[model samples]
Target chain A: MSVHLLYAFAGAGVFTIGLFGMVFMVHLLRKLLAFNLMGSGTFLVLVGLAQHRNGVDPVPQALVLTGIVVAIAATALALVLIRRYFHLTGQVTLEPGSRDDEGHS
Target chain B: MTSWLLDGLVVFMLLATAVSVLASRSLFRAVVMFIAFGMLMALAWVRLQAPDIALAEAAIGAGLTGVLLLDAVAHFRRGPDKERGGAS
Candidate 1:
């Protein structure tokens, strides 16, 4: 296979792994990590596939650049929200019984 | 031949780190693995002939995001009581 095709396959694997982690992981931070991983995987597939067909495309690369910036902003915002949630609830995971005393108040 | 070997190595490391980021026992270790994954991603971008992305991945992906997540990890490690105490 071509080099770009190899990277594209790798990206698919990463995306699947991230999807599994996002679904199964209990901790919000871990979920956020999985979300970022998924984004990265998508970016890789975009660039790799585009370049695989058309030899060093600039459009997809630019798109991925913008995506990376947006991703960091989203991650920071998620971390802030997570910290606030932890401060109020004292729980990391969103599983039930995290706020038993409050009782959904 | 050498280039293909190098590309394969980078891809392998990328997947390995991505898995470890989820599978790690400790939260801090997981975040650290994520940072390493970002750096490897930068290398992958370089191999893909996206130098601009490699730079951004190195700066934002590995450096800034790593520091941000590390700070959050430290905050979580402090426990809610301590954080509340310090905040108030």
Candidate 2:
């Protein structure tokens, strides 16, 4: 098998593993980490697919670049929310009853 | 020389990184492993002939994401619920 194809397969496998980890892990931080892994895996696949006879496709590379920016923005927002939730409830895990409304009523 | 062998080694490293990322005990360790994974992924991109992706991955995937994760870990560590660090 060509090296490029191998990278594609391995990336897909890691992507799946990371997806499973994100879904099963109870910790929010771990979930976030898993999500990053999945994103990297997707990037790897895109890179592999972009490889061509003379050169790689610039289109997929551009898309992947955009994806990385979006991922970082989303991650920053999520981290802010996690911090706010912790300050409000003093708990890492978000409990349904721990909402701000419960404190007032 | 067998060139395919080196490719196989890269695949093994990628798989190992995936496992470490999922199985790491400490949140910090997991995040670090993820950064390593991104670096390896960039190498894979270069191997695949996508220099643009290699540059993007090195910058945004590894650099920006690493900063974001470190900030998150710090945010969580400073919470009032220090007693419940392992509540997860």
Q: Fraction of reference contacts reproduced per prediction? A: 0.65, 0.74
Q: Which stretches of model 1 miss by more than 4 angstroms?
A: A98-105, B84-88
Error of 1 at B59 (Å): 0.1
- Clashing residue pairs, backbone N/CA/C < 3 A, model 1: none
* Candidate number achieving the greatest DockQ relative to the actual structure: 1
Q: Tens digits of per-residue lDDT for model 1 on A1-105? A: 689888988899899989999999888889999999999999999999999999999999999999999999999999999989888888878896663221111
Question: Per-residue CA lDDT of candidate 2, range B1-88, in tens?
Answer: 3667767777788889888987977767778888888788777777777777678778876898888887666656555556356542
Per-model C-alpha lDDT, please? Answer: 0.90, 0.73
Name the lDDT value of residue A98 in candidate 1.
62
What lDDT tens digits, residue by residue, belong to model 2 across residues A5-66?
67777878888988998888767777777787787778767666555332557787788878
The TM-score values for the models, in the order shown, are: 0.93, 0.81
Measured on C-alpha atoms, candidate 1 has an lDDT of 0.90
Residue A73 local lDDT, model 2: 90
> Chain B in candidate 2 has what TM-score?
0.83
Name the lDDT value of residue B30 in candidate 1: 92
